[model samples]
Target: MVLNKKGIIFSLLAIGLAGLFVLLFATGYQQRLDDQNDVIRARITSLDQGVDSFYDYAAEAQTIAGTAALDALYQEINQSGTFLTSDNFESNFTRCLNSSDGCENDLNLSVLLTNYSAIIATSLHADVQFSVNDVCLTQETFWDLVVRTNISISLTDTYAAWDTSRDITTTISTVGTYDPAYVAISASYGGAEDRRVFPTSIAPNSSRWNISTFMDFYKGRQYQASQNGSCLSDRYEGSWTSSFQGCNLESVVDADEHPRLKDPANQSITHMDWQVLTRDMHACHDPVTNPDDFRVSISDADDSLVLWNKDTIRYGLYPDHLDFSSPTYNAPGCP
Candidate 1:
């Protein structure tokens, strides 16, 4: 009888322990579910924010592009003999051709394009200057008058976006992880691990060649742009004629003492035929920049949106940057 009583007690204890295990497991699973739900919520929030922001982004970009006060201001500036000018723009581009063919005209298209979907972030400034009357330009005229322009973004902004993309992904990845790391960027997602990089520079013709890695960080918000066949090409035999009277460069003197830069002053040529597209863009931010460097009337825009002045537009196009600090989830089993 004593043996039977002891066995009964042992059975009770076993049943209680089993109940406790189930309770504890239930609680832990609920917590994990909550964590997973939180991540889903964050993803939803980010997407919703992007969706809601589309209108504002479009409006803001449009205001800068057309029919807004900024456009009016540009028009006013353009009219007041305050012509926006880009001059002496040399093609600081290197050949990215794989063919052993010569670099000349190897670029089938003058390309200055973002590889992914992009919206104008922060502030944008567009300036245009064309001649007042149709003018004939000979080799002498192109040398004399000059035609040039630039389309560029600041290095600070570019690098900031690069770094921030990784940071944000890292911050969002701490859930359900042993040691949290950043989200992985894949090649299809524009990951850049296969190429080479020069961490110290992004200069024109700086040979900042890295394999696919340079573009790995390109998250559609960032940029990789190239411009070619501008001002000098096979079409005009290297001479450019202008639709306006005389180019703005007519008033400017060469800061350099190169004899080839000297003006020929041969004004007798007529019927201009050749053309050039001065679309020079380099990404660099000087060490020192302030509110004035991005000069625009910042009335009621997002604080993050900035407008950079000419002086603030620095030259590095690709800075050597790689971070393994945040773990990369380049391949998530999740769709």
Candidate 2:
């Protein structure tokens, strides 16, 4: 009976020991699983931070680039009369092509570098693209002029109410008539001409008459008749007539009536007045008229760097899926 009791006690003790072992094993297994899960969460978090950092860097770069471009545009527009000659254009363009570090002095290279560096430092991969659009030269001109001349002539009766005389005075006067008429009835030989015989009458109802007048008597009728004659008559008339005849006087006196007569004969001679001419001329000479299109791509190979690995694994960093895109870059002379 005692032996049976000992066996029963031993069996109970064995069962208890087995239960403890099983409990310990399960607890250890659970702990290992928990540790693995924590590691994975931590890695994911680090990857997210790295990705954020990269994006921050890219944003900074884009801002710098945009500012630089704007500054360059302004400088080109407001530059002084040191006008961009063909040689200057070519030299500047060549420098840009050769990636000349000195070009920054003439342009806003500091801004570009800030942008480029920011992007390169933050991103696992990067590249640069530049381009230009259409360019054309424009020209314009401006001028001022003065003209001087003198002549003797019969003017239209613009102020008929103010004059009632056969003799027009030596004083200068302004008239606004389209036409006027006169008549002469003279009996004269070669004797000194008489002015009294000549009759200057403003027809009361004449549609074109503005004024009329009579002159003092003179010995020579020939001189009076000659005064009322046409411009050609003043040079060729040798004799005076006694018969009455009608005469018409017409003239044009405004020099400014024709406006376009003074303009530059051609565009090539007048381009300096236009503000855009300089820029267009430079672009034409430089041949930088169009911008080029480009694409930015990133692959897994770029993520192999230690920093990237640390971000991905230790820091749980991950990238925002690259926005694979074919983007366009435009500059001054691109089409």
Candidate 3:
């Protein structure tokens, strides 16, 4: 009876040991699986953050590049009196964006993206590539100049077995950029072929009006006729010939050397300067005393008046024509 009881106790102890081993093995296996899942989740979160950062960086770059390009275009028009053309805009934009192209102010868009990709590659232990397919520019509103582009970004990580591509659009604003009216007036005179700049420089030019005399006759509040010492009527002096007669640079007496226009100047457009655009440059030579002989009155119904074509006007985009002189103003004896 004693030997049989000892055998039963030994058998029960062996079965208990086997159950404990199985329980320990199951717990260890579950813990290992949980640790692996946590690592994967952490990696996914890191990748998501990286992607978001990349998008933000790209957007900022595009905006800066677009702003630079737009600014350059306006400068070109301002300096050279050139008109904008849609067909040549992409090339011009690229030139402005690249520093190597001799652009006055270059953002170097390609180099910026390359450096950004390198930083991303180092952080994620992956390969990053950015490709620019096309650049499209649009003026959505008078204040908004939108830059849309086909930018493709590819990210690949071998360890995570992850690869992805994304497309993004970038925008820029010109709310307070170059004056729109200034550009319109400059372009209206002539494009690059026959560029003409207003507020003529303080130098001698037979064809264009000199700044000193222009201000004296048009903007001077104390303007007078040289012959009579009488105040000349404030009007657009569009009728003048090479003889320099009748209320012109040679005939008018300017009391103020640096004259201020009656109306406040905005974007450099003077009241008389803008009004001159409404009439033809009629050549008049009055040797005798005639106050109104060489004057082109804005109120004159006989004088041809031009109105801006609102139907074809656009903001920041190319307008083929604006209400300005066609065969631009020129003094007699000019080639």
Candidate 4:
């Protein structure tokens, strides 16, 4: 059969043109896909930034709120000269944090957070929500306390959404707050003019007793590391009701118990134990000439040692065992 060259040539040309059309279609489709992906990635990046910005605002609000509440509480304590119980402190802190009318010291955390959240929404043009769940105070150092605020945050943008919670904390130095013990001491013992003595008149269990406050003030002077396992040292009490004589070294705690008396961080010791340790001042020593007056006697063996003694005891006499002059002193006299 005679070959049709022109027809064959036309067939080849048509086949080539068809393949070329398919190649062009594939390249165009891939380029469009890349552009779409790029736009999505950009939107995701912007949304991520919005979430971060929201977090920053929430953290800052927590710090300011915590500090303000603490400062206000401090002022209240200063003006009243009354030691607020732990429960009272917590209640007041929450009241101050959420109060719309603001505290007497002029701080309103509720208003601060609301304004901050509004700013975030306006700037990012995104939906945002913030809720403060809790504010807690924990011991950081002997002289420092930490305030932690937990906040829940949710943010939604056109391309992304985020929901999370975090704890934002701030440290408050005791130096700034002034030693709470000193405040109690000055108020109870006739200001700085009188020797800060632990009045024997106030029963150890009395709510007005400042032993726990003094323990915190004493810092490193804890029971576990101090005495030889007993809460009171051996001493004669001639002035007692003719019945109580020698040191009644009460219940002896295990060597490992109450490793840290001032442990605000872990709180290893119970409140009851804390009370017992501070209240046993009368168990070991003779009440001074005046039953209302309790004198702290230092050991002659070691000037830093806290010994239970009668009114005739010698050196290292400061208010009880917790004194400013001695840092290494330990009082392990009561169970």
Candidate 5:
């Protein structure tokens, strides 16, 4: 009986040790599962933050790209100051064509586009595209170019040119001072009888005596080149000098009129016009006619002179000089 009791005590001790091991394993497994769940939750939170960042980045990237486009537009405007003026435009265009190696002052398409694109790429891996209305500033279009960014937002404009023309024919108030020989030569060539003779009012020839001044009528020694009315003008700021009608061109442009986004809330937007005009100063002259057009006409009922569309038209000759009867014709005859 003493041996049996000792054996039972040993068996019970073994059972208790096995139960402690089972309890420890159950608690450890549960703790491991809890730790794994916490790790998963932290990962999920991190993923959500990443997604928010991506959205913000895309939106901010769009804003940056748009701003860059505006900067480019402003650059175009600043660089092309008064380039549309007749004097600057014609001369520069001619120079470009006459160049053998091509024009150095020609428009640089790559520079304009690449500069804009590089700025965006360096800041963010975004796409950008640029195109100009006219590659050479041909004065063909109102919009210099269109810039598209993020494949959605775009900016551009439309332009139209209007020219004013009117009749500018008038009788001369005075024949202006002329050399006696020149007067004699003019009278002999029927210049005095020319109703189309421009008065001493036009530019460069403002002090001229008659239309025969430009006529190659031999003044006995020198050959005269037909003097067309001309005005000296500088590009980028002003128009042609006018002693008669104003030689100005007007331009009007219209865009979608999109407001600039001043803040993120789409509020406090500012608007600006796309139109720019050649607002030149009025020319100095006597008895200022109309500033509306560069054309004019003058008449004395007997004869009429029309300076229309850059041409002089005469319907009749000076009074009594009809059929061209010189008061006193005395010349060595045609050479």
Candidate 6:
């Protein structure tokens, strides 16, 4: 009995110790799992914040770009008359780099600078083209002095966009009545196969010539008169020969040339051939006339006129023609 009792005690002690060990181990394991959970939660929160920050930055960038583009457009229109021509457009755009109140907001100005620099560089290297249709004349001599005229201007531009080619176009029509008395005479004399005269008209008498000839004479006189203030000594000036004096002029002539020679018989219809005097004027910018942060460039190409990265301005006479005015006929010397 004594030996059996001693064996039982030893067995009981071993079992008790094993149970304690297992309990302690289980407690430690649970604590470790809790610590790991906390770490994971902290990491996830940090990741979320980083993603939010990235989106905010992108949104800000977009806003800056959009505002800068609009502001630059407004400035360009206001200054179009002074510096927005084809000749000085590049230089004018460079001047826009200066940040004034109009373009000085830190974010917007920075965006403007970045984009404009790229645009200017591209424009400088880009190819441009322009064309004009000669004025078509439907009427001949009206009152032997005035002529009607019509003209068209076309421009076009081609360039690369995203490594691909693109094109834009602009067209304009200008009609006005002009006095033949003020027209410019070509270098050649005696209607000597002058290429300037088109759809030639001949009169029955030597004194009264066709409207085309009269217009040529008027144009020559106008140019000369512009320089000297008078149409005297012009080649078109000549004595009225016999037989031509009796011809009746068109009614349009009486409306164009009144006062003494308002006879209805003295008027006749004449068409004026139009020619382009000037094309591809350069862009310009004068700090004295306009004070702004951004610069602009304008060009006419492929029958399209562009104000370089901006909307067209309506402030000046030429640009105004873009919005208003249709072509009409008057004596070349009426002005």
Q: Which stretches of candidate 5 lie over 4 Å from their true place?
A: 76-335
How would you encode candidate 3's per-residue C-alpha lDDT over 161-250 as one tens digit per residue? 444445556656543444322343434444312211122222222223323344343433222222221111111111112112232222
Off by over 4 Å in 2: 69-335
Whole-structure CA lDDT of model 3? 0.45
- Of the two candidates 2 and 3, the one with more favorable lDDT, higher being better, is 3
Query: Each model's TM-score, in the order given?
Result: 0.23, 0.27, 0.50, 0.48, 0.27, 0.24
lDDT of 1: 0.24
Q: Model 1, range 1-335, lDDT digits (tens) per residue?
A: 99999999999999999999999999999999999889767654544444334333322332222112212222222233222223311221111111112222222111111101133232211111111111112222211222111222221231122111110000011111110000111112232121111122232233342323222322211111112111211111123333233221111111121122222331111012101111111112232432121111111222111122333322112111222223222112111
Candidate 6 matches the true fold with a TM-score of 0.24
In the order shown, the candidates' Cα RMSDs to the true structure are 28.4, 43.5, 16.2, 14.1, 24.5, 25.5
Clashes of each: 31, 42, 0, 3, 12, 63
TM-score of 5: 0.27
| TM-score of candidate 2 against the unseen true structure | 0.27
- Write out the backbone clash pairs for model 3: none
Model 3 ranges with Cα > 4 A deviation: 1-10, 72-86, 94-106, 161-167, 175-335
* Better structure of 2 and 6 per TM-score: 2
Tens-digit lDDT string for candidate 6 (1-335): 99999889988988988898898899899999998888766644543433343234323443343333323422443233111333332222223322334443344423443444344335443322211112111111222211111212112223222221112121111112221221212111222111111122332222333333334433442111011111111112211111122211211111122221223332211111111111132234332343221112123322211211011121211222332132222212111
- Predicted candidate 2 versus true structure: per-residue lDDT over 244-314, tens digit per residue: 23221111111122122123342231111111111111112111221111101122323310111101211
Task: Score residue 39 of candidate 1 by CA lDDT.
Answer: 75
| Tens digit of per-residue lDDT, candidate 4, span 185-286 | 234334421112121222332234233433432343222111111111110111111121221211212112233322453232222122223322223343
